[model samples]
Target: MFLYMLIYLAYHGSRWIPRKQRLKFQIVNAVVITLVLVPQFYVIGRSKSSRYCKQPLLNNLSASIAFSFIASGFSVIFTLIEPIPQSLWASYHLFGLLSCGEGLCTTILTLTAKDCVKTTPELYYMSLFQTVASILSTGFFMVRGGLWLTKLNPGTDLSGNNESPAVPH
Candidate 1:
């Protein structure tokens, strides 16, 4: 969820900056994001050392590492493709899809992990909240994309003229 939020913010927040400065900003953002994961890796290592290597704990640790690596790869790819205007939009769209998938998976896991929720009600609620938020944002993006496509290709008449409804001047 944190990863999703970070990606969301980075995607939208970078758009306003001048093109020349974006590369620098992205470099800094990548460094910060990678640095932030250090503590998480440490915590996971400590959990294992403390003999709390339960399935949930291990699953979370693995997911964290996997997500971190995937995010780093995305950062590299985005940096490489930044020069292409269309690539940026495509990246954002792909991220939206990824967020939706993640939300669905998280919701399913939360629903099925009855024991986990019973043991940790707070975590369950937090997971539910993240899932709901992701789904809402993804829905908004889908609707927005549909509207954009419609605007791009408004209906045409048989004469092949654009068929926007007549409007008074």
Candidate 2:
């Protein structure tokens, strides 16, 4: 899906950007998400005279918070259970994929439903932004996780094979 592509693109692009600037990138991501969502909710909410219009934004905010909690919990579990080579980047990617899946499902459900209709570009863009944000956030976290892992276990084989200095995943 398109969300997956954005995650991967962001994930790989992280390599080109300086490590120190990642936090700033994340901040920009947060801002973009907010910018995209507010207008989107307004447009979508206004178009549908249904009572549900006012609720989607609230639902989305709650969902985002819940998603963050769930993603963090899963990441912690993975860090403790999986022999993930101390690469937080992998975790970030894993988390990003899960988040993207959540966003993708949410968008698909919203667009496909006849009961709740979004009749404007504003709403569509807002949905698109959330999807993109989900992907970017995941990508950022994965990259950060990988960087952390590498820092934690430098010169150690995370892949469990002692043959190569670093096991290629």
Candidate 3:
């Protein structure tokens, strides 16, 4: 991961940015990645260590609140960075990096939460549903954001025209 970041920055992000602004871009992006990763690392570690000792997060009110805050922070950080990348390359790379991180988060949840799912079948179904729904929504919003970045309206039909279809309702 560290090596990938070094190569990614040197070859991709910094190469396209102005020489004078390259350092700032790299630093800010590195910091952003770090900020996003720390909590994920914590969650992965906690999942491993808490297999037997910890209470179910869904069963505990305060713990659920704390988890909610962490989730919100994760979302808010992504939201804040959504418009920062000006170029298509940068935007796609940022999305790739974030999606890579999200892959780990999703993988860890699937692996570590199996025990809980065994005890509660609904948890499995709910997680599956949420995972699919969130992925779809995230992709959709990113596409819309990209359209906005390119000075296009997402509501318009992009099939070689600006006309939007009328809603049946």
Candidate 4:
């Protein structure tokens, strides 16, 4: 999930670079984004035949896959549509919210496990930490999205507009 978030950030942040260089970077971004999902698919496939497959773990994995798919779809669409900055910002926040759902499922799974014999201290700590991080990230993305929306009009074409709304000096 963190990897996906970083990729999303890089894909969006590429807009800050000069246009001539942006195309090459975006191509690379798309490749990397696709590569990142390979391991996840492998994990899901391996888990399918495993005797220890549990509901919470499966839920977490499925949510993560859904988030990845949605992010990938949006990234491709953004590249084709060249949406405004406000849309990009909103997409990132939406991704963050989806990530929170994955984190919550993981936390619940970790907490409600009926069998402690298979669980370890490290697993518990990791889930707890991730839940906290996801909550924090959700808040951060929401605030950042709101700020961007306020600063940039959603209807404006940022691709061609050179002048942004005036800021008080």
RMSD, one per candidate, in order: 6.2, 10.5, 12.5, 8.4
Q: Taking the tens digit of each residue's C-alpha lDDT, what string does model 1 give over 1-169?
A: 4455556566556667776678787787778676747655665555232342122533544565577566666555554555548876686557555655666776676666555544544444445555575566666667767777666656864455878788899
Model 1: residue 111 alpha-carbon error in angstroms: 2.0
- Collision pairs in model 2: 86-149, 88-145, 88-146, 89-142, 89-145, 89-146, 92-141, 92-142, 93-142, 96-138
Candidate 3 ranges beyond 4 A from true positions = 1-17, 47-137, 141-169
lDDT of 4 by residue, 2-106 (tens): 533554576567777765667776787688667756655665565232335343554465566677677776665555445548877786667766666676677
lDDT of 2: 0.51
Candidate maximizing TM-score: 4
Q: Which residue pairs overlap in candidate 4's backbone?
A: none
Ranking by lDDT: 4, 1, 2, 3
Separately for all candidates shown, the number of backbone clashes (residues 3 or more apart, or on different chains) is 0, 10, 0, 0
Q: After superposition, how far is residue 61 of candidate 1 from its true place, in Å?
A: 5.8
The true-versus-predicted C-alpha distance at residue 18 of model 3, in Å, is: 2.2
* Tens-digit per-residue lDDT, 1-169, candidate 3: 2222333333445446655555576566556556544543444344343344222423322232334344434333333342434574455456446544553454356455666655544434344443454466556556756777656565556465656677798
Please report, in order, the local distance difference test score of every candidate based on alpha carbons.
0.59, 0.51, 0.45, 0.59
Ranking by TM-score: 4, 1, 2, 3
